[model samples]
Target: MPAFGLMPISYRAIGVAVLLAIVAGGAAALSWHIQDWRYGRQLADLAKTQAEALNQLTLAAANQQRAEQDKRLALEQRLQASDQTYSKALSDAQRDQGRLRDRLATADLRLSVLVDPSDADAGSGVSAASGAGGMVHGTVRARLEPAHAQRIIGITDAGDRGLIALQACQAYVRALAR
Candidate 1:
């Protein structure tokens, strides 16, 4: 007897075993391919979402910048208008001040003539006649009566009140004459 306990191996069994191994490997490869495809799709979707978010953020930032610029421009325009108004006011004040100075000078001259008739320049055409005690223009009758002249002199003599008192005194004189 050759080998009583040993069983002989068959080629059919080996071929069947190899076929099963190939099928199992093919199944595993298909499963791995499907998993990779899903992972790639998920990554693409995440990228798309991130891109949309970035776009929205960019648009918001741009809008904010535009609003800031608009505000700055409006502020600048307001400042310019205020500056122009201030300049105009200053100009008007200066002009009024100049006119006031001129009036004050004329009033001072007239007052000087009235206070001292001897100091009156003949060419100035302002004179205080003897009995009138009031200023008389050359060849013209006295416009202020003696009482009005005295009252105006008293008002002016009281230490430098503003022009309002002088204006009031003149108005009073005019009303008395009327």
Candidate 2:
């Protein structure tokens, strides 16, 4: 055997060291690739979660809008029904007013025919009474008869009441139309 140094160097040992270094480098590279793949998976999971949350938010907004539309539609229907009811009531009131006017006109005509011509002309038109001895004579001077005066007052009162009632009815109808 040749003289060996304190630390002997051999070709087989050098080869073994080179092989170990190559294996260590390949393992390190594989570890780095695995870490990168794990990072990418985590990012994908985070994006999926955010997308799901956004979808939920969109769905909630759509539902709220639909509810609002339904409410508005229902309100419009109610308003339409109210308008129809008011229109019908107004029409009925108009018909009643027409009938009342016709009846009043007929009553007025009958009353006019029953009234004496002399009595009708006593106030403003030509009087038919003849003056005798400076005393103006008229158809008994309606004011002198107590019974006739009372009856006339009663009739006037009734007419005033009727007019008041008619005015009130008209006002009520106007209010309803509004």
Candidate 3:
């Protein structure tokens, strides 16, 4: 009743199938390990490059900051020097002004005497012979030397600038009278 050319399953064929499956599993595992190693190397290279870039950036930033600090310091030094110069100039100007004021006062006193030599003697007639040219302490002379008289006359010509006011004149007159 069995059909010709029909065969039953063998244990040897099952063993060959199992062997093939094992070989395929080994190949797949090898491929996965290789891919993992390649990816790891790529990641390592990327990290190294990033680290280098960060270091460069940090160095550049430090340099920039130092340069800016130096500029600020230079500006501050210039400002300090300018302040010192300004202070010195102000002091010099003030000194010059004081000198000018003293000169003006002396000129005014000289003019006051010229405009009214009588005012110099006032009611007392003290013979303000505190004489004409410079100052004469004693003895009235019959006449003044031409040059001394000219010098006294010159004081009046400072033209209004050196002349004392009427009030100032009266004050001087009073002071003289005293």
Q: Against the true structure, what is every candidate's RMSD?
A: 15.5, 13.0, 17.3
lDDT against the true structure, per candidate, is 0.61, 0.62, 0.60
Best candidate according to lDDT: 2
For each candidate, give its TM-score against the true structure.
0.51, 0.54, 0.49
Q: Model 3, which residues run further than 4 Å from truth?
A: 1-13, 106-178
Model 1 ranges with Cα > 4 A deviation: 1-13, 106-178
Q: Compute the lDDT for candidate 3.
A: 0.60
Candidate 3 or 1, higher TM-score: 1
State the lDDT at 167 in candidate 3. 33
Q: Summarize candidate 3's per-residue lDDT along 1-178 as a digit string, tens digits.
A: 3479667658899889999999899889999999999999999999999999999999999999999998778666665665565556555555654554555545532223322455534554434445566655654323444445445444443322233234344544544454
lDDT of 1 by residue, 1-178 (tens): 3398767768899899899999999999999999999999999999999999999999999999999998778666665665565556555555655554555545532322233444445454555455445535442333454445445654543423344345445544544454
Q: Show model 2 residue runs off by greater than 4 Å.
A: 1-9, 108-178
Total backbone collisions for each predicted model: 0, 0, 1
How far residue 53's Cα lies from its native spot in candidate 3, in Å, is 0.9
lDDT of 2 by residue, 51-157 (tens): 99999999999999999998778666665665566556555655655554454545531211123555667674433444575644544322223344345445665
